[model samples]
Target: MTDALAIATDLMPVLARHAAAADAGAAFPHDSVRALREAGLFGLLVPAEYGGMDGDLADLVDVAAVLAGGCLSTAMIWAMHCQQVDAVVRHAGERLRSDLLPRIAQEGYYLASVTTEPSKGGHLLTASSALLPEDDDLLVRRDAPIVTGGEHADGFLITMRAGPDAAPSDVSLVHLHRDQVEAQVVRDWNAMGMRGTRSVGMTLSGVAASHQVIGQPGGFRAIAVDSMIPAGHLAWSACWLGTARGALDAVVALIRSRHVPSSMSRDSELLRQRLARARIDIELAGGYLALVRDEVLRRRHSGQPLDDRSLQIRIDTVKVACSELTFSAVDRLVQLGGAMIGYQRDAAVPLERHFRDLRSASLNYSNDRLVGAIGTMTLLDGAGRLP
Candidate 1:
């Protein structure tokens, strides 16, 4: 229920302080996370009864976009936590919900997901971990690469296969508690950008289970289709939208501050074209996000099921468009910027971080796979469409 701009204001200074260290040390943005929790973002997805915002996807988009304006890594980490809570609300049992909801809502506990597997090609399809019957608890081990928020997460929304190899395969989303899971920062993430997210590789070996099971075994796809697709797509789009917005602002400043300026009529036609086209691309993606989000709020969040194949196609298309557009805008900004923004956190630093972070959008295996799935569905009469 917080005003969007207020949230933006709360994060600006917090993002700047840790923005340097995050990239320098390749660490999680602990200060920015503290700021987000103080701003009540950790509870943004849980129910109001438990002192959470109980926000819709539109609210999520607003908060995420604002946070991305400040720090992309912090924003993306919160996005993962947002998805974790959303899944819990839909699929957790009463015992699980009752035990954890209040604790997280009040304490601002950090959360993340450990889903990408080594063999399954960096997505849900090939989960190597198995949740077997271990007397009263579940026993599971998993290997995940590029686990966002892994280094300091209190827990993870782990996706796993169930039963023995000969047993019927069941996929479940289980909460791997901190005590039971071992999340090591195995590799140094000296990337071109988004250093604060601490996206690292995780090796979970026979971890103990926690509350919140996202539906029955072998149901990862259902959890994704039902609870995650709309929300995650919109959230990442908003994150990149923030990046595009920052780039726009930076380029405008660049134009104004530089010598041989446009006002002197010395601005090259090429530069003007790049700026104008970047503007159009950003605005188009913004419009697409706004339009689809309204539909999501009016239909998807109104207790209406989001199962229509056509609607799913719209979701995939919009995601692909926004991601592609944002990346293009960043590229344009960098091309126009030349050598000025090559370094870290300064006038040029935000664009540098944004450029690197924007790449994560389409590179997400699940998101990319959806693009192809939607195309085949449109071309093949929805016979084997995977949404």
Candidate 2:
């Protein structure tokens, strides 16, 4: 295993140990986060010169999948943080890069995204909040319906209109240190699963230096199209796969430990066949994820633009397919394990937690929206037979 994957593997027990309690209380996994920080995973995507691993998308996928097997919430937090890091490393000005990247590597500074706005919901391409000039800095007061890991983020990458009069699509990304922002929790996070994410609704008032604006004014569309969307989809898909794999492992263990009577031998065989089918689904989802990951890495290495219609369609399809496939696989595994093992909260198997968490995979990004978008893109591309 690569060093990054090994570190993530070693930390799995730590994440698993606290996952239940964290999920029970809907609390952040402090111990798990601490373990990840100490392991230097926060710098997984940072450049080597910045004291990071200098890892690529493949590394992120492997590490995220392993970590998610232990605790989906912790893995998701790390994945989202890495996504923000990618944006900063690629688009942020020299000043912001110099200030945040090193700290993120050495001090394990966690970054949070503040993109979703109340008016626009999950329509991240546009922003309703505008950045106003204040003396020597830019001031922004934005409210988001959901800010994942917001309460614990050391920094924030916020999206806003370039100015009061700028068009909604004329968005800019600004970096704000936690100290520069005053955040008020507007809604508590009480969810069915992935509760440890602490995705609370909050109103944030912050000031950022002029140099902290990443890329150019009205340039956020490019950043999202090029970086955020792909990274988020890939990482989220990995987590869903991991969650399904974890449950499958639990179900297998439960089956192995039980002794079936000869009269039920045929039933046992049927159960094994069902399990095999679920495993096949999981493998298919994983294969597709790997394929997309390699394609993305190839484009990045060759300095090829990622905005190609075909590539975008593949990325979106992978997300939709993986989320749906993994969720279905986990549901089947849960059924095979039966109610006593899968449905009981205190059962030896943890399939119940996995089932609950995986359910959110489809709803988080809303597969319907993605499917509609994919269809529109395909229809608009006259040169396309298939993407």
Candidate 3:
């Protein structure tokens, strides 16, 4: 925790410098991103073979929470970077894994989620992007609606669906170099919160694909079901927990700096109850994430299946629990913070961006839907007609 705190504290000045500009400019966190790269924070999950921390899930959560405490948008961007790294570790070629990962660890390359679409939306689904076969190469055309750090990422783990027209081409993950692929921003993203993340809509045209994939194309069912979504959900638990911590930090600072309003901050019992409840919820949320993450580590090392019915259940539970708790914490912090919280330009107000970035959780994993499926899978002894 102290190491995570120290790393976060060192990054605060840099993060603060860009937090407002990014929010106001509706631009990417380029400066803070560069600092993250220089700090070697991007390789937190890269395997030790590639000079990465090969950091456990716990470490990932800690770092995410720390940064989310400072700026949720930046933290999510970093989380996306870790997600990209995770894909390679789970599925990329030996050449890519060997050559690219080391540079990611040492030099710090940018990683982004080139997923998320409105029409054939497959934020985590492989059966959504449109793919066209052209001779030996496949032409992948993707229209992502909310791709985080789309313009800034050095590379993207883009998802494309095999359209009904193409040969039964396999659906899988492909790496897109910024220079090689045509990533044109289709829409401006001026979301009220998490604006700094630059989660813009993008269209990928005429992107050529190589043989290196994140599992066999048609075999993406395994990658998404068994690996990608679950890993992403677990990683987000850490990120939202960080947002909760950051929100709490914001309230504390506000209390210290502002004159407490007598209506709520001073002598109101209801307000006090709400604040107390928020505190309990955030702590409980954090604990849930920590416990599940520890379980993940234990299972990973021991080569044992999770005690939970499917690995997805625990992942879903943690995501739902933390996402709800963090959002509540942010709201309560603003309540306790009064009008000052609404002033986005102020450096001290943490609620604005935290509010926006935390929203990505449910959309990415959707624990509510996962729970029903988990119940059927566990009690019925088989995954049912739910998907």
Candidate 4:
């Protein structure tokens, strides 16, 4: 196994042990996060020169899948953290990169993304909050409807209008340490699933050094297109697939451990068929994830533009497909396990939790919106035979 995957594998028991308590209390998985930090998994993507492993997308996929099998909430928080890390690595200026990347590598500084604004709904490409000049520093005050793991993050990567006069689409990404920002929790997070994420609403006011702006001002569009979308989608897909796989494993184990009644041989055969179907769905989702990962890696290595139409479609489709397919797989496993076993809160198998967590998969990004966007892109590609 790869070092990253091995590290995540070793932390599964710790994650599983705390998963139920964290979910019950809607608390952040502090122990799980501590274990990951101690294992140095936070530096899995940092460059080697910065004392990191410089792992690739495949490594992320493997690690997320393994981690999610233990606790989907913890795995998702890790994935989101990695997404912000990638942004900093790819777009941060020299000063910011030198200051933060090393600290992230050595100290495991957790980072969070602040993109969704109060009035903008789910739109992430534009920002209503503007960065105003304050002497030598840039000042920004913004309110987000939801900031995942906001309370636990050591730093934030915020999105804002490039300047007071800039258009909504002229956005910039700014980094601020927790000490640099005055933040207030505006709303508590009491969600149906993925409770450990603690994605609460917050208002933040911060002054960032001019050098903290990632890439050029008004250049966030490129950053999102090239790095953010791909990283977030792939990592989330892996997590969802892992959750479904974990549920399947749990149910299968429960079945094997119990003695089957000979009188119900026909029903037993049907259950086996359903399990086989669930396995096939999981396999198909995993296969597609691997294909997308390889394609993304190939493009990055070849220095090809990631914004190409064909690849963009594939990236978006992978997220939608994996989210739907994995949820379906878990749903099948839940039904196969039946109400007495799967629906029980304290059952041997944790299918209830898996079912609830996977329910958010489609709504997280809204598969309807993605499908519509994909359709528009497809219509725009008049020369498209196949991608």
Q: Which 10-residue span in candidate 3 carries the lowest summed lDDT?
A: 162-171
Tens-digit lDDT track of model 1 for 119-228 = 77665544666777777777777777778877777777887876566232367778867777665666656666677887887777655544446577667677787677
Q: What is the Å distance of residue 337 in model 4 from its true position?
A: 1.2
lDDT of 2 at 174: 89
Better of 1 and 4 by lDDT: 4
Candidate 2's C-alpha runs over 4 A off are: 258-267, 382-387
Per-model TM-score on C-alpha atoms: 0.89, 0.96, 0.86, 0.96
Candidate-wise lDDT, in order: 0.74, 0.87, 0.70, 0.88
Best by TM-score: 4
Model 3 lDDT per residue over 33-98, tens place: 888888878888888888877776667777777776666778888887786787777777787688
Give lDDT tens digits, candidate 2, residues 1-387: 899999999998899999999899999999999999989999999999888999888888999999999999999999999999999888888888888989999899999998888798777788999999989899989997888899999999999999999999999998889999998889999999989999999999988889989999879988987789888889889988988888788666656655532322335777878788899989999998998898898999999989988888888888999989998897887677666665789977677888888888887877888898899888877445432
Task: Mark the regions of model 4 whose C-alpha exceeds 4 Å error after superposition.
Answer: 259-267, 382-387
* Per-residue lDDT of model 4, residues 270-337, tens digit only: 88888889999999899989988898889888988799887888898899999989988988877776
* Backbone clashes in model 3, listed as residue pairs: 65-242, 129-161, 171-217
lDDT of 1 at 84: 77
